[model samples]
Target chain A: MDHKEFIRGGTALSEDEIKSGKIFVEEDALDCRYAWDTGVAIGRYLAELKKGKIIAKKTNCCDRIMIPPRMFCELCYRPSGAWTYVQDTGVVNTFSISNIYYDASRVPSGEPNPMPAVIEIDGASKGMGIMHLLGEVKPEDVKIGMKVKAVWKPESERTGSITDIEYFKPY
Target chain B: MRKVAVVGAGMTKFARRALETPKELSYQASKAALDSAGMKLKDIDCVAHGSAPDAFDGIHQKGEYLADGCGGWNKPTMRVFVGGATGVHAIAHGWYHVASGLADTCLVVCEEKMSSAMPHAQAFFLTIFDAITERALGLNLIWIFALEMKRYMERYGYTKEDMALSAMKNKNQGLKHPASQFYGGNELTVEDILNSEVMASPVSRLDVSPVSDGAAAIVLASERTARRLTDKPVWIEGVGWCLDTAYWATRDLYYPRYTEIAARKAYKMAGIREPHKEINIAEPYDPFGYKQLHHMEGLLLSPKGKTVELLRDGHFDMDGNLPMCPSGGLLGVGNPIAAAGTLKLCELFWQLRGEAGERQVPGNPRLGVAQAWGDLMQVSSVVVMGINNA
Candidate 1:
């Protein structure tokens, strides 16, 4: 009979029984607002990343080139045809550094460890990439094929948002 | 295509916060899988339910709030998310409701609380990214397992002492598991997981998998209600699932093409054409220690660059020659993401019914496999069990 004595026994709760209100903690709040619609190929790729440009779409079934710019072609589901643009510079294709922070906490002893990567964007296709952030070197000198680029933020602090570029560095 | 079996199994203590309620951990793993299938929950006949996110139980339509604690009141129930392959796709949708004659007993369950997500449940895993391009790069979830363990240690040159020997052999087989949650009787090495704390750079902190709070269950039947409830029915021979493009950086983060196309559609529906020689125990979903050698080379059961020389030649220990994870899986039985894939299909139906006391595994095993993997590295879900007529 010992299937771990038929399971069930976990009642843990104590943070002073959820702050002394004697365990009745139900204070909601997740508006999770949205307006999203970046359609028509991520709305012309966020209006060509506020005109500093990056685009992509161009598809002919699956010769690649799709990027964060959609409007169809997830392997010839059709539509997507011409837009192109690309080179915000790329390579990295994998990187991490991180020292924790996105709520798993940690990162404070003299900061700078955020790294993040997956860059691969230059001229649209070969492994399409995008997850950003890698600023001005040294997380032991990056390198997963290095060569980075896209550090945007200027044109009157443009904001078509994906935080208007401001990151990928190394070049 | 009409067999289905796992007659019963259950779970719950893999804690790190579980003050019951997620419908009392789905009515204590669906009342210990309907009292280990001695049956009665009006002899079940359809339920399913497998959770993973309602943002870790801060509930919303969480399958109608976990349908009356999993017996799924008023019957014909359903709920089958695919992130962390929702408990083996809710036992492959209760093996398609008892292999399609539409239920002759089903059940299923699987829960998770993840301490009702607040400031830290890895902050709702940053809403599984890409909300406007990888959630604007604040990024979390151990930076995609430290960028897929540095593209699988730079395409198989391997190390981090070869992924801390799978977090020291799944936390030393989760110290003989009775529902382990990082089972602690000490041991852990490989220089204590290469001295622990690197949280994302070849990913450390003992290579991930913890955040838990659990529930797991199973029942399934048909084959004439599993030969009237049990004569050791582990059977559900095959089930598969796939998924792939969530554009997770346009693929190839060192292989797992949707766990080798869901292990070749469950080895072509279990006619089993050599899953590294007819599978014999494996629970592929480590929640990171190089995702158990990238799902043992995507469940073809170790090959692509030889799972770190067959995990440095112990060949996946727990008395080797193919015994991986032996229930100490989501790195020592805890990752409550869809009750850690139905606790690896209730530890392969108690290790194919010898009833896994002390996490069994010594070659009495008659074919097993459990796979889970999830979204943003894009889904996977396989199943395949055996012993009924073995």
Candidate 2:
């Protein structure tokens, strides 16, 4: 058992100073972990991305195409989905300010961070927004309908993961 | 269909950390509710349980694991989940058990042990996303709320300070609740909220509920059984629930239409013509401060993009024309996901019975509505309750 710090009479402390009290100490905490069974599919996708290729999937229902392939379309409920590729360019549809750094644990942790904008990729239609860090322009410099391009990592560092392309900046 | 009434409501001490096992926590609340209703386990014909996520408890098939504690043993029991909306959904499920004549009495329990999980509850939320698309992007749960809040602010011309008032108002109201954590009138200012830790852009730490460990249970009985038990039984007058598309990427995030649809159905069934003028009080799910305003608009208690103005005008306070979250809401009372919703139900029970005491609204409130939203914010469940409707 541990007793949290409570100041006595040494000096005055700001509320901000008192707020940082929980920054460090922790104990035997239980956490949940997930291991995907479909590792082979992920592995193959990474390999393709490393070769500098983009991927998509075609839903059998309306025959509409989707990126980052999937097995089923919850919307159409049709089975037997397959992979398709697309040209590697999309546009920013809508955006917003994210000044706080958050996750479940740390959000309640009472900390703070800079805000990032909600960016819609170029090729994606309206309402298909993905969260990625923004760079190359200030928050004031960013605007809706701004033309931005993905800043991909060096060829050798390309992986099938989202990190392959870093933050999107002014085109 | 038969009429249904809530005969009893019980809850564990709402806290930031509860050391008991989920089973133990479930037992504590379930037993209290049963005892309060002067009923035994044998009196329950069916059981309904709700837990927000197995990740919160670190157990899969959470319903089965917690079944025995909720008295589901060898009976017609089922677990219902709708993200954060599970608590109210459980109540709705229990209402059906008696309304459909499937059971004479139903035990509804909601429990969450967020403290049991480590690293952060934020990590578990990472999995709520699409593994390929959103998950790969390393999204936090608040990212959605922050983005939604930003959109709501933009659409309605609401300022960050306007949203902060919810935190101040709700937390202050919480001071009156015996089970509230941050009670004692520790007032909060908009500057205080803005200066507090930022969780996501435009969403501050103070603007959100704490990760809590608690449980709440309510007993729903058929009209006959309820009359036999007590004359002051709180009747479940109307119930409605809806789920929106799980694809968060495909819909307009500025407003939650699911909540509006659910509220409309409940209000209609309850014969409420104008919710704000008819209903005496409300408990809109407030896991996030801005959510209270967002859902206020969806519930039609206030006009679209006008809840912030209502809040600013002090129209939603305890002494306001229509008091809201008089139970402290999830923000001040602490949010254990499912249990938070049920606690709102309990608050309504007390309010309608004129037994809310110090935390109770000043007038004799005859009717109140409680709402909960969950599942990537795609589901809404509402329950309208009254003291004499039975």
| TM-score of chain A, all candidates | 0.30, 0.62
Clashing pairs in 1: none
Distance from true position, residue B274, model 2, in Å? 3.3
Per-residue lDDT tens digits of candidate 1, residues B1-390?
588888888888878777777778888888887898888889887798888768766677788978998889898998888777888988988898778887788889888888777767887778778677677667877787788789888876887888888777887788778678555566687888888899778788877878878888888888877887677788888888888888787776888888888888888888998898788888888987778788888888887988888888888787888888888788776788888988888888888777788778876888888989887768889998989545
Best-performing candidate as measured by lDDT:
1
Evaluated on CA atoms against the true complex, candidate 2 attains a DockQ of 0.19
Interface CA RMSD, all predictions: 12.1, 10.4
Off by over 4 Å in 2: A1-117, A139-145
RMSD of 2: 6.6
**lDDT accuracy of residue B200 in candidate 1:** 73
| lDDT accuracy of residue A70 in candidate 1 | 81
Scanning candidate 1 chain B in windows of ten residues, the lowest lDDT window is B178-187
In the range B1-390, model 2's lDDT, one tens digit per residue, is: 898999888777667765467788888888878877889999999999999888776677999999998999989999999889999999999899999998999999998888656656766887777676457666767787777777777777788888888877888777777666665757777788889966665778889888787888999999999999988898998999998876665567788899989999999888998998988899999988889888988888888977877887879988898898998989888898999999899889878877776787887888899999988879999999987633
